[model samples]
Target: MANTWNGSDDPVTRIHRQCRWSTSTLQMTDLESDTTSECTNRWIHIRHLPSQFNIDLLANCSEYPLFDDFCPYLPNHGLGQKTHNRSHSWYRTDSHMLELIFHRRMLEYPCLTSDPDAADAIYLPYYAGIDSIRYLYGPDVNSSFEHGLDLFQFLRHYDSSHIWGKHNGHDHFVVMARPAWDFSQPLSNDPPIWGTSFLELPEFYNLTALTLESRAWPWQEQAIPYPTSFHPPNMALLDSWVSRVRRSRRTTLMLFAGGGGVSASPNIRRSIRLECENSTSTSIGNSGYSKLCDFVDCSNGICEHDPIRFMRPMLQSSFCLQPPGDTPTRRSTFDGIVAGCIPVFFEDQAAKSQYGWHLPEEQYGEFSVFIQKEDVVFKGVRILDVLTSIPRARVRRMRESVLELIPRVMYRKHGSSLGLRNKNDAFDIAIEGTLQRIKSRLAEISVR
Candidate 1:
């Protein structure tokens, strides 16, 4: 029998007491009183899923396609390995860990309610991102939809209260680590093009999804930031990094840290690389344009092993070149924002059409530069000439704007007890957005 004293509280009671204290502290320090009340009223209920959908996927990571050993990326509650310093909050976080990170963060969310009837929104903790990888490269492509089908089938049968059936999943949300394209595979493709048909199911139609990249139409999906290496545990550490980047001495005009042939058209990356190489010798008037650009040859996976090699160049450069890789979006866009370097995007779809929930469409010019892919690849337009033409004053303003957006794009370290006053990081913004979306949908339904 467990030890029980006459006047002592039980273990469950003690845990509840701690949770109440933590929630109260967060309410007083993190958000305004009004915001706290609003969040409290909008309670979330996380669905208790089977182990196979989440934990089992991580336990058998090696069996996943294309990865030799995937266990390293699953440590520290999906924050990956701590890089260099044990004291600092930097980790070698994989971009695909959004599902893991978001799930862990949601578990600690103050708005969580145990009573399903009182929940304003339902959270489906499915590891669709990691689960999709299993069927991506194998001959069993047709079986890619099996896991998703199984998940919804279980939900339909096991949910005694019909939580999802209440609004046809309009009030429920899921965070997908991968892009929307990976789950939107059409069933009519003769050879079955690259992705699973998870999104095509009639059951997922009304569900709200947060993904790294959303489709152009964006009916039920919203774009969220990809996880970066720096996960600050407190506002102080985040502020320190921001101050350091603001004070960084940028000597290079531009930087391209990735390799070529990542996109279907190799010419785009090739053109950018050639420009970076040729600019080393070319000079413009008085700006030391001879050292115009720096390029890191990440062809051998050096950037993955050591992020400093990729981040150092970004730190010293005024702008980071972000070309489309496979898709119109790249994780490097968020990396540039974290380093306080202005992003130079080659496609409108890369930034303008995507990330509308976090990054306002009107503010694109304030923090980033857009160069047409056609102009760079086909017209042979000089990247240096265009960048150099921008006045020093404008560049400084853009960098400042980029720095200001750092917190919104970052995922705060899970289980952080430190108080963050009046600031919402990526996770907070995502939850607020999801709740607001669900609230609005529920209100509309009530009127009918």
Candidate 2:
């Protein structure tokens, strides 16, 4: 087992060590102050909620089939295909990684403080996304509203002595693993939808919520990317994988690895599939079982759900097709980026607006390709032509930009002793951005 720190080190010594390492390898030019010092100094108090709200929620893992990560590639990053000796298994459908990452990191994070009085913010570590999904498929699935009500009751009746009570929950925040659409269930007498009514509650108005996707309204909510299968245990491992990706040769112009492309639906999936099949250089791969088994040969479930199978083709392709999945944002976007492929996004809002904090603040053209959905659906504009139109040099720059953004888009190493010391992993950026927002909010309140 790695020697994980338990916040016992002297603050000055740790900060200086972090500074020395960060200045050498990582530099956040966009960040104003010293990121290592700011992140370590920002104290956060983790709320102790009942197991029902978090861990115990996944007790009956059978109901939530996605939690089943017993595949052959359990914890190997290289998916058992790569020749590299240092690799860890990662599952694409493992949405539970977000909760696991947070739970493990909070313990190791230097900012976390047991004392509420010294905390800069209160973190409500409720597994909101997972709990909601459990109810969505459980006995009282129709009455998902009850899930939100139960949480509201928990917060309203929570101990007022807690730091959350001081600011009417303004200083408190929660990290949700699912998109906001999963929790923003309608309240009216209209037909029932997919998710719970958690975000609809008045109690969550002031508190900050970090979700995989966020609605444009309610400025308190922030967008985060879905967790991917690539998790490097240390900076060396990360550097090694990145170096391999940089050296790998990419031949294909583009590729699309998705199912459910047939059935004549008006969805972009089918459109993308059609384009991929028609293109000369593009390859279409399959993984998850889809009803389009007859149209596509691989749809017979040949491509098993594994990290290598999903990302290998991506690494060989120059561009990866990213159409909206069930939600506006797809996990494939991050996968494509990590694989060093330039993502071609059909909807601008999907990646451009959703991940403002973590993604580069510059124009989307710098790192990705954007073709308006209407162009493909109505105008019949060919995806291949649009991609081919871009100059080769521009495409190269975009792919390089995507490669640089990999560390920021990826989840940090879980249970690391350094606690994002020299790396700018996704968790580090999210927490740092959240802290900055909290400080700004407190400053605004003070001035008012």
Most accurate candidate by TM-score = 1
Model 1 alpha-carbon drift over 4 Å, by segment: 1-36, 85-87, 261-266, 288-290, 444-448
Deviation in Å, model 1, residue 210 alpha carbon: 1.0
lDDT of the candidates, in the order given: 0.78, 0.66
Model 2's TM-score against the true structure: 0.80
- For residues 144-184, write the lDDT of model 2, one tens digit per residue: 76665666677667655445557777788888887887788
Q: What does candidate 1's lDDT look like per residue over 167-247, in tens digits?
A: 888888998898999998876665677788878877788788999998988478888888888888878898899999999
**Which residue pairs come into collision in candidate 1?**
none
